[model samples]
Target chain A: MSDPLLKVDNLHVEFKTGSIITRAVNGVTFELNEQENIGIVGESGSGKSVTATSILQLIPSPPAKVANGAIYFKGKNLLKLSSKEMRKIRGNEISMIFQDPSTSLNPVFTVGNQLIETIRAHKKVSKKQAKQKAISLLDLVGIPAPDKRIDMYPHEFSGGMRQRVMIAIALACDPEVLIADEPTTALDVTVQAQILNLMKELQERLGMSIIMITHDLGVVWETCDKLLVMYAGRVVESASVKDLYQQPLHPYTWGLLDSQISEGQNSAEPLASIPGSPPDLSYEIKGCPFVERCPYAQDICYQETPQLNETIQGHAVACHFQTSEHQLERKEREYSDGDAT
Target chain B: MMETLLEVNGLKKHFPVSNPIPFKKSTQSVKAVDGVNFDVYQGETLGIVGESGCGKSTMARLVNQLIKPTDGSVIFKKQNLIDMPAEKLRQMRQKIQMVFQDPYASLDPRLKVGELIAEPLVIHQIGDRTSQKQRVEELLEIVGLNKRYADRYPHEFSGGQRQRINIARALTLNPELVICDEPVSALDVSVQAQVINLLNKLQQDFKLTYIFISHDLNVVRYMCDRIAVMYLGRIVEIGTFEEIYANPQHPYTKALFSAIPKESPFEEKERIILKGTVPSPLNPPSGCHFHERCPVAIDICKTKEPKMITKEKIHQTSCHLAD
Candidate 1:
């Protein structure tokens, strides 16, 4: 196939607190096809957000250090780009929408000002033109009364409105890639659906690749074409959305799927939560990061880190078992039988 | 069937919004909770699901008497909680507690973990100092925290650990009913499961009733025995989990269920996307609050308010079409 729109190879991110260094992203690698939407799903501190930020070179300095990694965007290595080049790429070629709009947005600036500034930063346009573009962007995001809302400050808008404003700003430059980090985690269910659908529609219209970082598998299934499961700063599983849900290879993926199952089905059976807390990143480990929490962990899993292995078509799982085909067939049989009953 | 632990009738909380301009009409009341009615049965979880600004949190606070209702009666075991004296209210508080959303802010930073848990027991004068200490330790153990960490301050604990401590403090009084307002929304997905499991175990062990309020339908579906869907200061649907999920009658209910992300690898279900944002509680729609955005809205839905009509046994919904 042609070169992916973005390619991440052997990426590692470390944070220094006092004298100790914590590896937040370790040897992570993934490829995003042009105009494809991929979701990186994991709980907080799982390095999902960090991985996205690393691609854009948004990691804060002093404490945060990208020790090793190669991030290629449209055949250009993002890591090797100078500060000036990176600035041009950010919000011009790539943009990100953070989790909480209440805090992510500047309180003092009007929504229009933020949108205009983002546009002017990338394009040499007149102030009036920028303002017009701002209004159109707001209108595109489905914000009603865009002309009136343009002058309203962030605090004036409600939580959901503020999120829409953030989206408008993110799309100001019509970037080729959009990194949405937990975009709807703070919104209610109905509002969440609205935002997700809006993103999907915008992706189709703009034909831009999107990296959706969220812990919710439900969100991933709804919007994402591919799924990457992260754990303790590592990509434990990566596969097509259909394959991951149909025949999950990693135990962590199984656990996540099981947890969500009890939500959809009103079963009296207790939810199957992962056994232990996520491993501490401050200390280095010899084996798999999820070994402590995995129910199917073996001595080999604890003794040596497993490489990402292709166990089924378009499915890669970093686990020793490699029984995805067997499990997939079994589940299909059970599902058909259950439906027949 | 479990006994009813708490019953709320016509509960309302109206906050007066003052005009910014001086000498202007001073205050206009916002009906945050407008005549909401529900019950908490012993050992059962009642989930209150709503959008933001739908007054779910306000209802939770009113049930705990954190904020007194403007008009209504809260009958806890047949005693009118609204009419109860302050001392009597204080006494009643021992049997009812609350767990707030933000673990970081809800906890006292200066106080040790042990003192945080002990404060409730001390306030109610449940036992002697030594026994209270022992109880605090026991509570920690029950919530899956090591008793040895009780001396540590709130800042030292992880988000999940702090929430576990919050749950422990809420359970210190052995309350019959606990109101959890978005308790797990702030935690990670994996940690959310851990805290939810702890809550389920505690409910079973102590026969505690829970008024679980959340905007997340997934979490509510897993936790609640019965679910209530709320819109601008009103409950649009209330029924058993099975009844609502399997056979949702209200248009809003169907829209909500469709909004939830499907887990299976099947084709996507056509979502009934609501038209507009939730109406302002300050000035909600005249008739049915959801009529402004309801896809199946009729003329009567905009002109005449619908009453809570019973469809199936114990299933109640406020929709003109349901009639």
Candidate 2:
């Protein structure tokens, strides 16, 4: 494969106030290749968003601080860059689409004004030229009558349309990497499907990598090539979509995969819910964050933390037993299940 | 023999729309829930699933009597709740309870968890303070929450725990019928599973009937014994979970099933992409409301609304092309 487009190495982000310190992103390390769609799946406070924002240096600093890490985009350390240098990369080289489109777009200005301003900020262009570019961007994202719609305010657009506008602005610069944080979580299923398909099409046409941060496992399967599972501000598992779904090694990953109730997979038996809530991030986590809820947790699970270890060619699991005898047990069980069926 | 626990017929709740432009006299109403009909069998979970503007939630509120329906007859236990006296209706409310979508908003922040749960019993005069405290502790235990949490506040608990508290509160009067309005939608997938499992266990342990309302197709299928598909305030289809999932007749139901993001990568499923958004309820298309977005809509769909007709035993559909 070509050289990875983005590399996040040993990244740690913390939010501190007075004596309390919440380590939001703890030692998150991953690589995203060009033209690859990477999915970050985690519950709230799992530090998925923190990890993304850290790459862009977008975290508000009074409470949030990048304690340690190196984020290399095209062989340049983003953490070492000055504010002026970071601004050059923010929207031009990398753009982010937030969860709520209604709140993200400026309500006071027309869509045209905002889009034109973003284009002009990145490159030298006359107001008329920027306007034309903005209209084209709108048309590119599949909004009909771009000229008429561009002049309309954000409120005039529906939830799905506003999201289309958000995508239009994000793609105006033709950024190399697009980070979408729960882009369709707020939309209806049909609308969400449209947005996901739109993003898929845009990524293919534009040749940009996508980092999709969401809690939905189903979404990851539909859009992403690689999956990163986060738990309690830590990377718990990483693998290709097929590998991770087929053989999820981490106990937390197992619980998550088993718990979902998609169409046609109705089980009369109650779902296997991961017991207990996520660990509090304000204090230091002594051992595995998921140990409290993991049914397969051993004594070592509570005593020490496990690093992400590759058991197969591409699958990496963060668990003690996963690297040991658990694999044998799982194979035996699968064989028995296969035989019975 | 199945006994009907609750029955609703021709239920409607329309709110008059306000025109954005001044002096544009608005005669239109946002038909939030229009002419919905369903029967909840005793001890069976009935799910109402639909996206926004479909009126699944308004149906829940109407059943709970939280808001009076514009027109309909709601009969529970062989009594017409609509025409019931105020005192009689208040007494009947104790048998039916509702758990709201947002736990944070449903609960009074100032009240303690114990007080919050006991509020129902207190309003009904079920027991004295000492007995109520004991009952509250039992409720917390029933929902798999720490008994010590009775003294704690709602804010102290996480989203899952807060939902537990909300469930505990709903059961204070030992409500026979519990209407769950997206109880776990606000929670994470992991936490949602816990809550859903808890609801299932509680249903069996208490012999309670549930009117589970949610937009998540999976959750509805998992939780409900029978599923009702709503579209623009109408029951487009109703059937047993097996009947609906295995054989959904309505065009909207099929599209909804296809729209769900599938998890299995090995299975190559064909997705039916429904064009356009759900039209506004304010100016909904005449005849069949879903015709505008239906993939298989025909000419007849534009002129006349199909009545809910039985296609099989315990299966009903309202689509011209259902046959």
Candidate 3:
């Protein structure tokens, strides 16, 4: 097979203030193939966003740095590239949409102006040509009456419309990769569905690899072909969406799946929640980062750190346990016990 | 039959939109909680689900009398809270407590956890300082927090811990009805589940009735016994959890449910993508508020509003095409 579209190997990101250094992304490795959608699912402070930002070389120096990593895009190392070279690749190749659409957009400028600026920034085009392209992009993103609406400022649009505008800007330069960080988190469920569907349609039509960074597992199930479950700056589980959901290996993944209040869950049963919060990232850890919150944690769990190992074809897990049956048995017992309570 | 703890009757709150020219009486207003009515039973949770600006938060505020309504009556324990004097309402506030979203913003940074929790007790004059302090410690323990955390300030705690502090503060007065307005929306998924389980447990222990408001349908289903689906400041459907989930009659409710992300990638969900965003409340539709976007809307829907039609003993819906 040809090389993957983007490969992140042994990525580590850190932020330092004074003498304190917070390890945000620790040894995150994944591969995104052409036209394949990959989801990095994790809770807050899980470093999913940091990993995505570092791929585009957006992390600032001094306070924040990519301590180690090799991000290979088309067989070129993004980390080794200078700022000037990276700027050329930033919007022209890899574009990102942020969590909050309102703040990401410039309130003072019209949507057309911003899109045209991005188009002109990457390509050698006339202002009129860029404006026409911006209008077409807006139409492609499902914005109604792009010709008139494009002149309106960001505030004139609703949350969902503004998000579409953000997507239009990200796709302005026809980037090969689109990194969306919690794109639909701020919108309502209906609007979220709209945005997710739009992304799926755009990916298939444009044939570009998408890196979706979101906390919602349902979203991953809907849009992504593969997923990486991160906890405490490390991927606890990685597999195709079907394999991971059917038989998750890691304890953290079990906790996350159990905690979701699905249709089967009745009001009488207490939600099976992970007992404790994530560990602080500023300090150093000896063993597994999830040991503090793992329900089946044993002495070995706290004493030894588990590396990501492929247990099945294309399914990797970072845990001491090799079999998923053990995790399933434990999860069922916990659920039944919760029901009894 | 379950006893009604609180009743909301024809509640309406309209904020006047200021005219561009000064000193001109504004003719337009945003009908935030227009003609909303629901009842809270003695010990049950009633979930209100709606999108932002659909007035779920505004309705919560109106129920507690935090913001006065333009026209309506809030009957709490057979007494009208709207007409009650300030002193009497202050006395009545002990029975009705609220847990707000954004745990970080709801709490005061300068105050200790113990002092913050005890502030409700002190204001209500429920107990002496010594008893209040003891009650604060007990409440902290009840919410699954370390008793020693009482001395620390709000900034010291994580999001989940701070929310626990908020719950403790709300329970300090031993409220009969706790209105949680998107309590877990601000936290992470795992922490959100923890808070939800805590809320459920507290309800059983205290026999508390909760007016839970959230946009997350799954959380609403897991927490509430009865559900009310709201749209454009009005309830489109109200029914038992089983009824609402099993057979959603309202077009809006069905659309909302269909919009939820599928359980798995293998399950093919037919999503009903609404054509446009919710209409502006300032200039709401003339007839049925949802007619503009309703897929099954008819000719009469644009000229005439639909009243709440009782489908079953406990199930009601407001839609022209539901029948």
Best by TM-score: 3
Error of 3 at A274 (Å): 1.1
Between the candidate structures 1 and 3, which one is better when assessed by DockQ? 3
User: By TM-score, is 2 or 3 better?
Assistant: 3
Model 3 misplacement above 4 A: A323-341
Q: TM-score of predicted model 3? A: 0.97
lDDT of 3 by residue, A20-122 (tens): 9999989999999999899999889999998998999778877898899899999999999998999999988999999999899999999999999999999
Q: Which ten-residue region of model 2 chain B has the weakest summed lDDT? A: B263-272
Clashing pairs in 1: none
TM-score of chain B of 2: 0.96
- Candidate 2, residue A154: Cα displacement in angstroms equals 2.1
2 or 3: which has the higher lDDT?
A: 3
Global lDDT scores for all candidate models: 0.86, 0.86, 0.90
User: Sort by DockQ, best first: what order?
Assistant: 3, 2, 1
All candidates' chain B TM-scores are: 0.97, 0.96, 0.98
lDDT, residue A282, candidate 3: 98
TM-score value, chain A, candidate 3: 0.95
| Best model number under lDDT | 3
